[model samples]
Target: MYAYGIDLGTTYSCMARADQDGNIEIIKNIEGKNITPSVVEFISPTEIVVGETAKGDAILAPDNVVLYIKRSMGKQDENREHHGQTFTPEQISAFILKKLISDAEQMTGEKVSDVVITVPAYFGFDERQATENAGKIAGLNVLGIVNEPTAAAIAYGAQQKSKEDKVVLVYDLGGGTFDVTVAEIVGDKVTVVSTEGNHTLGGKDWDAELMSYFVAQFCEKTGVTADEIYEDGDVLNELILKTEDAKKELTSKNSSSFTLSMGRGKRAKLEVTVEKFDEITRHHLMSTLELTKIALKQAATKTSSKGKSCDQFDEIIFVGGSTRMRQVKEAMKKEFGVDPQVFEPDEAVARGAALLAHFLSTDQPQQTTGLGEGQSAADERFSEVTSKSYGVEAQIGNSMMLSHVILKNDAIPCSNTETYGTLAHNQRRVNIVVYESNIMEENTELSFGKRIADGQLDLPAGLPARSPIDVTFSLDRNGMLNITAVERFNGSKCNIIVKTEGLSESEVMTLQAQTSVIKVSDGA
Candidate 1:
């Protein structure tokens, strides 16, 4: 069985494998490209298109095209329908993975099955399982799911020659998501201390801002309303493409412009300067910095709790395409008092995942090109921390409130016990509704408590009021959650697997069969 590592990104995806001798090789897709844009289009019920070709068709068939489907992963209500055929986000993602795997087989000249896919560090149990379900639908055996920042840290640590272990922070701002992670590197092992991110915040927000700015400029000169232009699918799609290109251009150049053709033979040219771009998107940029600071503070708190002064990180590593923006690095420098290092923004995560694949495939120690032992190869054993708080809604007095059992930043594969008493006498049953919060702040607010799973615990009949019951939440290394509630008096317990909100076994099997019949094009 060949093991490969895949960075299933929001905007783009890449695949790579490790050779027997521990060398990492990136497999170009069928189009002979290193990266495949994460876009999918359905031309018919049986034919699906992926990558650059799908992206190109998006402007023409906006209704049938799906971009940024990754953002919709683990969502139970969101589905894409085209030509009377409905598809789940996992199903769309399966086609993307299938395309990558087909191209990988051509490059390796062998069957690829076992693979490690990387996701954002902040993904919860359901989101991670959705990714695994996509792998299953693609007929690939997912060995494990690694986090993107952890993968990048592994890749960066592989190139360093420092002997002493040091703390490092990774700021990953991709096309559709942003994540900040702090890790401690000791030899080959990279222990992730803390992570914070926004799955909906990324470069797309900047592109949208630029798009709106251009639309307003065009409206002012062409005597057309923004709504009129936006309602035109083709024109909106074209403007989106142009705005994305302009944003990329502004990354290196001080100013950029794109021409828009309005109706009635009127053409408007809209331009934006880098300063204006930064000013317009400054809040989003500051949000990333704020997350960075929070992650760092969490890391520092974790270390200080162990009687160590680890508040300062030795280095800041940048990853993902959005990190190419100048303001990102400037913000990092201003906050950290050091210039952040930019490695291969596009390939770092894939490369790191591939290295871990190599280690998992072989028993040989991971060593750098020239350095040996502690300085070169990182420790194989590492740990991860939870990114969000896990809790249940409890009825306190007259109102329902969040009762957190597992706080964020706690090391994974950990179990904690919290005791709560029965609300009334003879309470025979209790409801345990598990929720993963968007933030660690506890309250009765609407923004918190995204329910992932629930169960009913039946206690002994005729139990007295305020009966002692222990609730334990265990999070495994893969981020799979399990909740156990026990009645201390009788030792009776009920356990529920908090892995709902993703594809079920039957659903996965059905989708697997369905995807098996769909024909994906060989090239982009």
Candidate 2:
């Protein structure tokens, strides 16, 4: 059995496997393409289609096709009903995974059961769990969930063969998400200092911005309401698709023009210059830069105790297919006052993931950040930070407040304990709900986060009002969570598995069986 490293991306996904000689090779899909489109379409009750074919079929069967499913991974109410069948995000993702693994098996002629998947560094606890569940639904053993930026760093280190200690600012702008991570590479170990990102922002947003611009321009020239054109599904889809092409065209050209024909033989033609495109989408790029600065500032704050600043890191490394845009590189140059390096933007993450997969499956000694007593320079260690805060909801006086236990950016494989007293006299049971929050303070209003798990803890009967209960939040290296609450007085304990709101075990099993019956078309 071979362990593969998979970059299950929002727009595209790729996989890599190490050969018997320890050389990592990128595995192409059945179509002989390095990256497969993350698109899935349901053609019949027992037929599923993925990759380029599905993406091409989306225009004709928009209602049956699903794209950008990564954006809905951990949402509480995210589900798609296609052809009278409701599919959760995890199930849609599982179909994608199945396509990846099936093609990989055929391509390599090797059994693939264990794999390491990469996710955005800023993904919350629930999101990470959802990814793991997707792997499980695909009947694969997930070795770990490595962050995309860290994986890219590992690939960069291996490619450059640099032995000196340095810090890298990784800007990962993928098809449907954007993130910035600051990491320090010391010897063979990579430690993440800080990470910031917007899961809803990425190349798709840029395409949408350009689409809106074209629609607005068309409306002005044709004297038609924007809603009138947008209400036409076929016309709108075609226009959006053309706008994406135009965006890609402007990447190298000074301008690109497109024409749209309305009824009554009326048509409108519009030309978009590179400068105008940049002007219209400058705010989006600015948002990414702001996040980059935030990550840098956080890294600086972390290093201030040791007399360092954000300037300690001078080079910016870009990853993801979207980084191929000229405007992105221009803005990065202006922001950093130096030319940024694009290190295998499209393949770095997958390669790094392959390296990690190889490391975990082999008997090679693991790397450590500590002084080397017996560790080799070739071995690599990984460390991650929490993307969101973990806390419990508390009712103080007449208002509800969030009592934070772990703050964001805290190192992983860590645990924190917080004690709280019961509110009512003679309280025998308390409901403990674990929530993932983005707020930093202990008694802050939480406007963001999701409820991961909720359970009841039993206390001694007739317990006094001020009796204390100990709650502990533990996060593993993969960012999966476990919450335990203990009644100190009676020594009673309750454990909650911190997972996302999605299919239960039985539901997942049922879905898995159903998917097994639905044959996926081969990539072409």
Report RMSD (Å) for each prediction in the order shown.
3.7, 2.9
The TM-scores, one per candidate, come to: 0.92, 0.93
Question: How badly does each model clash, as a count of residue pairs?
Answer: 6, 0
**CA lDDT, every model vs. true structure:** 0.83, 0.83
User: Which 10-residue window of candidate 2 scores lowest in summed lDDT?
Assistant: 369-378
lDDT of 1 by residue, 394-421 (tens): 8666778888888888887789988888
- Which ranges of candidate 2 are over 4 A from the true structure? 19-22, 304-307, 363-380, 395-399
Residue 90 CA error for candidate 2 (Å)?
A: 1.2
Model 2 TM-score (2 dp): 0.93
Q: How accurate locally is residue 252 in candidate 1, as Cα lDDT from 0 to 100?
A: 92
Q: Against the hidden true structure, what lDDT does model 1 obtain?
A: 0.83
